[model samples]
Target: MPLPGQQSPLMIHWEASPEKQMDCQQKGKNNKTECFNHVRFLQRLNSTHLYACGTYAFHPLCAAIDANRFMLPSHFEEGKEKCPYDPARGYTGLIVDGGLYTATRYEFRSLPDIRRNLHQRPLKTEESPLHWLNDAEFVASVLVRESRDSPVGDDDKIYYFFTERAGEETTSFFDKSHVARVARVARVCKSDVGGKKILQRKWTSFMKARLVCYIPYYEVLRSVCSLDGGGWASTVFYAAFTLSAQWRTMEASAVCRYSISAVQRAFEGPYMEYQDSTRKWARYDGAVPEPRPGSCITDHSRRKGYNSSQDLPNSVLDFVKLHPLMFEEVKPAGGEPLLVKKSVAYSRLAVDRVQALDGRSYDVLFMGTGDGWLHKAVVVGSGIHIVEEVQVFRDLQPVESLVISHAQRSLYVGAASGIVQVPLATCARYTSCYDCILARDPYCAWDGRACRATATMDSTGLVQDIQSGNKGCRSISGRGSLPWKNRTVLQGDDVLLPCDQRSNLARAVWLLNGSEVLGMGQDRLRVGVDGLLVTDTLPQHSGEYRCYGEERGLQTLLAAYSLTVLPEIPRSPTAATPPHAASQAANDMKVAYISAIVTLVVLCAVLSTILLYMSCLEKRKGKYVLGEPRPSSVELQTVSANCLRKGHREEEEEEEELTYPDGCLRIIPGEAPTAATSPIKELPVAVPPLPPPLPAELTNGMGALPNVLRKMNGNSYMLLQQQEEPLVSPLYSASFTEELSKILEKRKHTQLVEKLDESSV
Candidate 1:
C-alpha cells in the first residue's frame, strides 16, 4: 500500500499461479490459508523501484515493483535460494550495492545457509559437519559502511543476528534447558568473493561470535533494532531476548544494547575450533596463518600481495573453513539490560533519535508486546523510564514488524489485523510541566502554556529535563489545573469526585485541603476506577478535594472539587407555644396511653385462652405429637426415586451446554443452546411432587376431627411444598463471566497493570 499526499491509498493485490497453487493443495496443504501468496521480503532497490519476494504457494518468486504505480511486472525471477519456500520460516536479508545478502532455508530438508546472490558468481557458506548454522532462527541483518575514512581502509561489512543450538554432545538434559541455544552475531565483508581453489564459490571472510546478555535464563534473541551513527565505530544495536521454551513459564523479557566496537573486537580475537575426538568446541592454540584467516581485505592485506579473496593461498582458505567461530563473546554495554520487564513479552523494537530542546540527541525506544501494546521509553543517564503505553491493535495478536519515519514523525505497526500509524510526538497527552518533565520523552516539552511537540516549535520557552525530572515545578503557576466544581449534599449522603488519568505509568493521589489522603480506604472514603468516592458526608469532609498524579515521586494536580454539607433543621416545637395547644396535646397523649393498655390486655387474654386449649387438646389425643410429623416408608421411597431421575436429567443437559472445542467461553442471556450459537442453557427442574397421601388410620378412625386438621396432622406436607430454584456455582457465574467481559472490553482501551502499589485503579 502507498499513501500519496492528498490522494486515496493504492493497494496492489498479488496472486499465486494456479498450477503452483494446485500442486501445493494436492500435497495436503490447506487451500484457503497455506496455498496463497505471502510477501515476506521487501526492500528499496533504488530511487524509483523496490525489490520484493513472496512465497507463491510453495514456489518462491521475486519481482521488481514500481514505486510510483505500486505495481509489478509480469515476469519474475526464481527466488529458490534468495527466499524461503515456506513463509513461516525465519528469513533475514538486505540489499547493498545491488547485491542481495540473505540468510534463509534454501530447500525443504536442507540446513539453513547464508548466501550472497545477484553477484557475478554467487557465493555461500560451506556445507560441513561442523554445523555453521544448526537450527538457526534469523532475526535481522544490517550493513555497516566502514569504507568511509577508515584508518586501515577496511571494506564494508554486513552483519547478521540469529540464535542456534550447540553441538550434540553438550545438549544433555541439564545443559540443553539452560545453555543449549545461544545468540550469535555474524559478519562478512561486502567486497569478498569465492576463494582461489580449496573452497570455490564460498565466503572466506565469514566469522561469528556469541552475543551475551547479563539476564539469567534469557539467551534466545527475539528481535533487533539498529542505530547507524554515520560511522561504523559509533553504531549500536538494541536486541530483545526471552527465556527458552523449557524454562518459559512467565511473561518476562529484556532489552540489551550493544556497541559495534565491542562486536568487532570479538571477531578479531581467538578462533574456536571443534575437536573431532572430544566433540566439543574450544579455543585454538595452533599455528597462525598469514593475513589472518577471517580478516577483511584492508590496506595492510593488499600490501601483502592479496588484493581479493580469490587470490588468497590454499593454506589460508583451508584455515578459514575450519575456524569460523570466534572464542570471545560480545557482551552488552552496561553489563546489564537497558530494561527488564515482567508480565510482558516484547516481540518487536524500533528506535528513533530525537534532538531535544536542550540540543542533546536521545534515543527513544518503541517496544511492541505480544498482547498488542506499545511501550515508549527514554534513556536517562544509566537508567530508563517508561513514558506511556498505547494499545495499537484491537485484537491480542503479536506485533510482526515496526517501521519509523523521521520526516513525518510517525511509527508504523504491523500485526494480524492490519497496519496502524501512530504519531511519535503525542506531547499533548501531558497537560502539565511536571508530567511532561517526568515523562522524560525527548520529542515532548512544556512551553509554559501547554505540552507541545519540540520538533514543530522553537526552544525559546520550551522546558525539558531528560536526565533529572525535578525542575522545581511544584510551584509553577497554572500547572495542569481545572476549575473548582461546587457540590452541595445533605448530611450523611455520599459524594463522588471525578478525575481521569491518561497515563498508566502515573498514579492518582487524592488530597483533602492541603494534606494527602492515606491509601484507598473503605470507611467513608476510597478511590474507585472512575474517581474518589466519599460516603457518609459530614461538615468535616466539606473542603477542597484535589487529585494529583504522581510518577517517580513527582506530582501534578489533575482535578479539584469543593463540597458543602448542610445540617438538618430542628422539627420539635419551641417554648412559645400557646396554652390551649399544650392542653390539647396533653389530653390526646392521656387518651392514647389508655387505648394502648386496653389493647395489650385484650391480646394477652386471647394468648392465654389459646395456650389452654392446645394443652387440653394434646392431652385428649395421645397419638398426636408436638413436633413435626414423620413421613411413612412409601413417601420416602417415592421422593428418593424422583431425586435420582432429576440428577440424570441435569447431567445430560450439562454435557450439551458445555461443548467448546476452541476453549472460548460464551454465554448469552435468553438464548437457546446450539452448535453454531451460544453454549448456555438452563437445566430443566423436576416439578414438586404431589402432597404425600394421608395416613389410612387417621382418615378411618378420626371421625370427630375437622377435614383440614386431620390432613395437616397426618404428615409434614408444608416442607415438601416449598421449593425454590438452585443458585449457580460461583466459578461459572463470576469468574467465567468476568473473562468474557474482558474479551469485550478489549475493543476499547485495554487496562494494563502497573508495577506500582499505589496506582489508581
Candidate 2:
C-alpha cells in the first residue's frame, strides 16, 4: 500500500489550511472519499501526540492529532471501512491503545469484506436481527463496562444504540411498515481484535440486544452520561429524538429512556436463524456457542494464556459472526417513560436526578427540539411530563449536541451557529406561592423574598412542601416596623394608587374605605397600570386605601396606604372673575352709554333755541325806541290841566312836565291818563333811566308808567338817529332812544319776565 520501497508514506503538514479543505474546493475531483466526513474526539495521550482520523479521507489517514496539529503515518490506515469521508455515511466508534472498534460498513473499493476484527453490521438475511440496519440510522455509542470495573481484570466492552427498519419489511419487496423502533444495544469486546489469518483484524464477539424506548431517528443523539445501578448489572441511557423531514412518525415528538439490563437479556436469549427447507428464518433453540461470546472475558481466560480473540480458533469466530443478534425485544425501565412530550422534536438531551421538597427524587431532563425550544420535564407518578418549554434559539437553529454542568446548574446546547448556556432553573423570577405552585417544577421553592432552590434535604420525598405567597411582608418576614404607605392628591385631579405585584398568578385586590374597589371597566374608578386609579379625586376620596393578594382563599396584605385629597387652591383674578358682578357692570355701562348720547343731543338743541330767541328779542326791542320814532300821521292831543287833575283826583297830583318816550306814546284829550282807559293797549318795552325832559309840544303829552316795563340803572342801548340836530330844534334828550340792552338781564331763579310782541308801523 505504501510506495513500494518506503516503509510508510508521509503526510505533508503546515500551519496553513488543512488539505481536506482543498479537496472540497476542486472542480474536477468529484469523489465521495475526497474529504473528511465525521470526527470523533479522542484523548490527548501526551503533550506531543493524540489519536484521530479524517474518516473516509482521500488517503485514508489515521492515528493523527495535535493541538497545532499533526498526522500519523499512513500505515495505520488499516481500511477505508474504519472511517468514511462522505457526510451521508454514519458510524459509532471509539479508540484505545491504537486499536479501533466500531459498528460500520466493512468494505474496500465498494466491495464487502466481512472478515474484520469487529463485525457490528448484520447479515442481509430477512430474518437476521442486524438485517434491520440495512436502512437504519446509528444513534450513539459509549463504553459501558471497562476492565477496571471487574476484580478479575476482564476485557472492556462498549454499548451501541441505534434504530432500524423492522424485520417484516425485509421479507416483502412492496409490503413495508413505516413504523420503526429503537435498536437498543450492540456490544464488542476490546480483546476481540483479530489476529493473522482467519477473520484477521475482525471482531470475534460482536452481538446486539434491544434497548427499550430509545428514539433512534437520528444518526447520533449523543450520550453525555449514564446512570448505573452500582456497576453494570443495571443501567439507563437518556437520549433525544428529532423528527426528520423525510418521515412523519408521530404528530408530536418525544424523548425516550432505555435500560442496559433489558439490552443484556435480549442478547442472551435465543437467536433467529435461517431454515433452508422452508426458505425462512426461525428462532434457534438447539445449541448456543461456548465461551458465552457476548460476555466479558475473566482473568481465568488469561490464566489459560488467552488474551485477545486471536487466541481463539476460527470455528468459534465464524459462529459468532453468524449469530450477531439476540431474540428478545427490550422494554423501557419501570415499563414507562421518565419524560415524554409532544409538538416538539427533541434532538439532544441531558438529564440530572434531583431531590424535591416532597422527600422524593426526580429526573430533570433538558431536551432540545428542532423547533428551537428547550423543554424541561420531570419524572412524576408513573410518567414523564413537561414542566415548561423555553425558547432558547431565537433564530431557530437546529440543536446538534448538549452538555451539562451540574455544579453550575446549567446545560450548554450546541448548534452549527453557536452555543447557548441555559440555567437548569430560574426560580428567582417567580416570587409568589401561586406562581411557584403553577410552575410545577421540582427544583424551585418560594422563599421569603424570592423563589429559591434548596439543596439540603434529609428525606427522599420532600418535593411537595412548597406553598406560600409573596405578601404580608411584615408578618411573614417578622419586620412589621416598616413605614406606612401614604399618598396625597389634589381634589379633581387624576390619581393612581400604586400596588406593584411581582407574582403573575396571584390576583391583586384593591380596598377603599374598608371595602372592595370597583372593577376595571368603570369610569373615574378603574384598575390602571400600577394598581387602582381615581380619575377624578374628590374630597370624599380621602381615606385609607389598601391592596391584598389572594391565593387559595387565603389573603395577604400586600400594601396599605392613607390617601388624602388636598383642597384645590384658587386661581388669580386675571384668570377668574365673579360672574354676578361682571354681568351687572356690563348692564350698567350699556345703559349709561346710551343715556349720555341722548343728553348731549338735547342740550345742543336747547342751547341753539335760546340763542336765536335772545337775538330776536334784542332786534324787536330796538323797534320800541321812541327817540327816533318814525313820523306817524295819527294826531296827538295835549291833555288839559283840569282833565289831568280830574284823572289824578284819586291820587296827589303834581303839575310836572314828564318827558316820556313820546316818540311812540299818543294821548287823546278826552281820555283819562290811565292804561285801562286807552283804546289801544301798548306793548311794554325795556327803558333806561330818562336823561333830560323835553318840551311838551315837541313830544306826546302822556308820560307812561307800566308795571310790566322795568327800569335799569344806566347801563343800556337804544336805536338813536345820528342826524345833526339844530340847536333851536328843541334840544331833545337824544341819548334816550330806547334800544333794549341785552334782551333780558340775568334773571333770578323765580323771575317771571313778561313777553313782548313784535309790531309794524
Candidate 3:
C-alpha cells in the first residue's frame, strides 16, 4: 500500500532512475546544472473525515440505524413521553474545522428528552464525558441528505435539511420529504460542560419550501482555498436535476454556484413572518426569543395569543428562485449524473488550462472521468472538441481523483487501484513542442528516437555561447566548418553578408593593408552587410577578412572570407573613381566646412537681427530718445495761462453791448452835450450814460439808493457832480465805432435819458 504522501500507483513507473538521481545530486552540489524535473505525480489523500475519529464517515450509517431504532418508540410515546426533537438526525456528516460531526433523526427526536435527562443525569460520551454544546437551539431539521448535499462550516454546529412529507394524491408524492427545512447546526463544546441545563439561544426558522419545485434542489458547500495562506472558509456550488414522470423523458440538470456571502446572510435570521396589527401577542418579529430554561407550556389557552420569534420576511424566502447555473440544461451522451468540478479544481486546474507562464492562452481541457479515463479536450469556437481519450484501467473503476503537475506537464490520475501518469502534450496533434520549449517545462521532447530540448541547433549553440561568454573573458571563435562559402569576384562586383542587423559589426574585418586604398582609416572603414568594397580592385587588394565582434561583452573573431582578384576585370574599368571624384570630394569637404561656418555666421546674424529688432520695437513702443529735453512744468503752466487770457479777450469781444432804446449817449447829457451839439464831429464815446429814475417797486427795499436820490433831489448842483459814470458797450467792435452815431439817432427814448441826466445834475 502506498503511503499518504506517495504518488499514486500508476505514476510509479515515471519515477527517476538511480543514476539520474545521483547526477541530479551531484549537479546540485557542483552548481553546474539547474535541474528541472518535468515529470512529477502527487496523490493527496481525502483525510478530511479522519478527525474526530472519522465521525463523518460513520454518521450516515449511524443515522440510518438510529432512524429505525427510534421510529416505533417515538410513535408509541407521542403525547405521553413528550419526545424531544431528534438531534442526531441533523448531523451534517461533513469535515469542519478539522473534525467530523453529525446530526441525526434520533437526536432531533430526543433533544427535549435529553435536556430533561440532563437535569437528572449528566450526558456523557466516550471522547469527552463532560462535553456540552453552549447556547444551542434546534431551529429546524438539519439532516436528511436527499441529493447528497452537504453544508459544511467551521463553527461547531451542524444543519439538517428536510421537507414535509407530501400527501399521496400530489404529483410529487415521493418528493414530499425533499422539501428543504434548515436548522441551526451546533455542537457541544468541551469547555461549556456542566454549566447550564437550558440553552440561552433558540433555533430560529428562516426559509421553508417544497424541495422538487425549487430550481437548485441540492447544494454542496466546501471551503475556499486561500491564496493568501488564510485557512479555509465556505464557498458553495450546487447540482440540480429536474425529472418528468413520462417514461424515458430526458431529465435536465445544471450546476449552480452560490457565493459564501449569500449563505451567511440566509442563516442569520428567519426569512418570513406574519404581523398582526390588532393583537400584540399575535404580532411576531423575526428574532429568536430567549428560551425558557425548565418551563414547559402545555395549555392551549396560554399558547393561543403567544408570539413566536421564528417569523421571517418574504424577501429572503425568495432565495430559492435564484439558480446559479441558468444555461447548463443539455445532457451529454452518457447517462451519468451531472458532476460539478470542485471549487479547487475550477480555481487551479481550469485556470491553468488557459493561462501558461508565457502569458499566452491555451485552449485545453483535462477531464478526469470516474471511469478511469482521461479525456483531453480543446476549446474550439463556441464548443469543445474532444482530442484524445485514454483508458488507463482495464476494469470500469472510476477515477477517484485527478491532479495536474504544471512543472512536468504531466497528469496524475488517482483510482481505486493506484495512480498513473500521462504526458499532456502526447495527446495533442501539434505536439506542443514550442510550448514545451518556451516554457522550459519539465517534460522533455521525444522525437520517436530520443528526448531532447526542442530548441534549434543554432539557437542552442547561441545560447551555449552566451553562457560560455558569461563565465570568463575568453573569445568565441568560429568553429570547424566556416558556416559560409568563399567567392572570388571581378572588379565592380558586389558581395553580401546575409547577417541580421543586430549582429556584431566589429566582428567583420577585411585585410586591405596591402592595397593602396586612398581613404582608408579606422573611422572611414564603413562596415555593413554589403561586404567591404575596395573600388577598382587592384591586384594587391585580394585578401581575407578575419571579422571580429564582441559576443556577450567579450571581443571575439568570426569566420574568414577569402577573395581573389579576377584577371577579366570590367572593360570600362568602372570600379575606378570618377574623373571629378577628387574635386567632388574636395568640394564636398569645402561645402561641409563652409556649411558649418555659414551656420555659425547665420546663427550669429539671427541673434544680432533679433537684438536690433527688439531695440527698434522698444523704441517704437516708446523708449526715451537720447539728447531730447522734456517739457518743464513752468513752461506748461505759462502756455496754459496765455491760452486762457486769449480765450477771455475773445469772449469779451464777442459779447454784444446793450444800448439805450433812444439810440443816444445818456452820459451826463445836461452837463455835457446832446448828440446834435456834440463837440467837433460829435465822436461817439464808446460808453453810454446811465439814466432813468429808479421805479418805486425797484427801490422799495433799497434804502441807500433812495436816500441818496432824495438828498440829491434838494440840490441839483450837488446832484450833477454826484452822478455816476456811464456804462460801456462791450459788443461794439473798434472798427464799427464810426457807425454808432447813425445807430443812436434811431431811438425815441434819447430825450428821456437827457432829462433824467439833467434832473440828476
Candidate 4:
C-alpha cells in the first residue's frame, strides 16, 4: 500500500469511472490506461506527496500506485509543443531542476480527430532545427551519462536512442521505405535550460549519430572495460542494425559495438551539409566554425561569456543546423557480429559482465524478441552460446523494454501488456551436472547449493573445470535413474526397453547381458525415438537390457531392465484347438478309429482263409509220398580221405629216409661192395594239389569232428591235448620228447650199410 520506502502507507481507489468521463472508457482503447502509463516518481516534494509524470497516459500525474488523488500541471500537454497523449507514441525523459527533459513527438492522432493509420512527417517551421525529432519517430531507450573527470554531477548529458524517417527519398513510391527509416540518436547537455526568447522551453544543443551494423533501433548496450591506474574507464555502445532494401539488405540482424569516444569525435568532427545541386547530403570540406556548435558549456567556455548555445553567434548555429549529423560512419567492433538473427527482430537487450569459473570474465547478453521470447547468450571462448530461451509472455507479444537489476540477479521486461520479472540465471533448472556444465553460461554456477549467479565481474570459482567437459561433474556420483524394472514376455512376442535420460547432451547405448548391442542392421534389435524396441524376441533375447548414456568418453548406466522370455508350451492336438474345434476333431477321430478296426478284422479273416486253403493243397499233393527216400532221388555225401586213394600216406613216405643202390662205390673194390647211399632229392609237384584232409566225421557231420589227423588250416602238425597252460609252440612238437634218439640210431645204421655194401662190391 505504501511506496518502496515510506513510513506510512499511501491510499488509492478506482478513480471516477472513465465514462463518468464515457470519454474515459475510450482513454486506453487505443493506447494504455491513464493510471498505469509509464509512471515515474520524479521527486519527493513532501512526506505525504511526490512529484511524478505518466508522460504517455495522464500527462505528468503526481500520484502513488494506489493514490486516491493525483496532481500535475494543467498545461502539461495542452500546448501543441508539449508531451504527446498517444500511448502508441514513445519518448525519452529525465528530470532536472523541476523541469522534465522529454524527447518525443507531441502529435499523431487526437481523440477529436479519428483518422486512418497515418505517419507523421516533419513540419517546416521557424524552430525546426530546435525540435529536431522528426514525425513518425519512435523513442527506444534513454540514458544519462556523467563526465568521469568532472566532480559536478549536474554536468551530465542525456541521450535518446530511436529510429525515424530518413530525409532521403527512395525510388519507389508507396513503399514502406519510400521515406526510408534510419536508426538515429540524439543527445543534449543537461545544463542548458532554454532561451527565454524565440527558443523558450526548447533544447539548445541537440545532436544525432547514425549506428551502422545490420539494423539499428531499439537497444544500445554499453561496454565498459577497466584500465590500469584507474584514471578513467573506456565505454562503447553495442547496437543492432537492419535494412528493408531487398537488394542490399543484411542476411541477419548484426550487433556492433561503437566506441563512445568515436561517437563524441563524430559529433565534434566534420559535418554533412546539404548539397542543393545533388539534392543530397554531402561532406562539408569547408573551414571549421567558431565557438564549436552543439557542444555542452565547459568550465573554460563559461569564463568566455559563451556558456550556452543562445549566447553563440548565428554563424555557429547556422552551421550546426546544416550539419546536425556526424560525417563519419562509426566503425563496428571487430568480428562478424556479437549476435545475428535472420527472422527475429530483437526488441530489447540488457547486458552484464560475468566471471566464469575459469577466472575469466564473460559478457552475457540477454536479448528480447518480438515473439515474447528472451534469449540468454554468453560469450564463451571466441563464440556465443545461447544457454536458454525463455518465453516470458503467454501471448507472444513484443518485448518492448528490458532492465537488468544486477544487485538482484534478475531481469525485468516490459511488454505491450505488462512488465515481468525473472531470474538472470536458470542453471538451477538443469537438474544434472552434465546439463549445467554443458550450458556454458558464465553467469551460472553450481555453487554446491544450487545453480546460483555471481555478480562479480571477475570470478570463476563455480565452474573452474567446465571447459574440461564433464570433469566438472566428476565429483557428482549420485543416481537419478529409476529403480530396476523386471519385465516378462512370451517367446515370439516383442519387447521395448525404456531409456528416460532427459539430457540430449549424451548418446544412448543399448546393452544385452553386459555386452554392447549393435543398434544398426538388427531387425530384432533397434533404438526407437523414446526407447529401444526389440522385435520377435527369442530365448537368447532374455537377459538384462541396460541403457547407458555416453557423453564425452564417459559411460553412465541410465536404466536397467531384467527381461525374461518364457518358453513355449507344447499342447496336444485337441488341446491346441478351441473347445468348439476340439469337440469336432474328437468326433472325426472316433469315426476314423472305428473304420480302421473294421478293416483290420476283415483283412485277418481273409488271410486265415487263404492259409487254410494252401495247407489243404500241400497235404493233398504230399498224400502220394511216403516217409522214405524217393527212388529217383540220390543223396550226395562227403567221403573220408581214408576211403579214397590214401594220397596223404605218400606225403608221409616223402618224410622217411630215402635209399639207392651203390653203383658209384663198385669202382672202389677195396671198399668190399660198399653201399652207395645218398639222400634222394624230392621232385616238385606239377599238378594242382588236392584239398587238405578233413576228419572222418568232418566230411559228413563235421560239426562233431575230433582232433586225429585233423587239417590244421593246411599244416599237418600233430595235435596235443590242451594243457593247463595255453602256449603257442610252432617249432616244439608235443610228441618230440623222445623222437630225437630214433633219428640218431637210424643215421648210424645208414652209414654202416654204406660201408658194408662198398666192401662187397
Q: Considering TM-score, where higher is better, how would the candidates rank from best to worst?
A: 1, 4, 2, 3
lDDT of candidate 3 over 1-761, digit per residue (tens): 88999964531122224554465456442212222222111111133211111111111111111222222121111111111122122222332332222322223223321121112222321111111221122222222121123232122223322222221122332344453221122223211122221221222221222222123223221111111112223322222222323213333322222323333333333322222343111212333332221111113312443232222222311221111111112122232322333211211112123432223343455555445666554433333434455787777675554566777766787666787887665512323222112222212233432334333222222111111222311223323334444657675454543322223223343434323332236432445554554455544556655444333333333445666767664445566776698666654333333233333443344345544654654565555232224233211000112333444465488743322211222222233333333232232223223233223222122111111111234323221111222322232222223322322332223322212333343
Per-model TM against the reference:
0.70, 0.50, 0.26, 0.55
Top candidate on lDDT is 1
User: For candidate 1, lDDT tens digit of each residue in 1-761?
Assistant: 44666677677788998999999999888898879888888999889999998889988899999999998887899988888888788899999999999998867777889998978878898877456787888999989998888999899999999988764344223444354777899999999988878778888899999897854334578899889855678899999887666655766788899999999999989888988899788889998799899889999989988999998888899898889898888998988888878788889999987787777778899999998999999876655688888999989999989999887779999997899999998998876677778788888888886888887877887888887765736464334547889999988899888888756766778878868573565468878657898888878878888887776677667888888888754455674556799766654333333333333443344345544654554576443231233233211101113343444465477643322211122222233333244333333222222223333223222111111111122322121211222432211233424433433343225332323133211
- Candidate 3 lDDT (Cα, 0 to 1): 0.31
- Quantify all predictions' global Cα lDDT against the true fold: 0.74, 0.53, 0.31, 0.53
lDDT of 2 by residue, 432-492 (tens): 5545554557787655445566653233322333232233232332212235678888889
RMSD (Cα, Å) for all candidates, in order, is 19.9, 32.5, 38.1, 33.8
Judged by lDDT against the true structure, how good is candidate 2? 0.53
Q: Which portions of model 2 show Cα errors greater than 4 Å? A: 1-22, 25-83, 95-136, 146-154, 168-182, 195-198, 212-225, 242-250, 275-281, 299-308, 313-315, 355-361, 385-387, 406-409, 433-447, 453-761
Error of 4 at 197 (Å): 8.4
When 2 and 3 are scored with TM-score, the better candidate is 2
TM-score of 1: 0.70
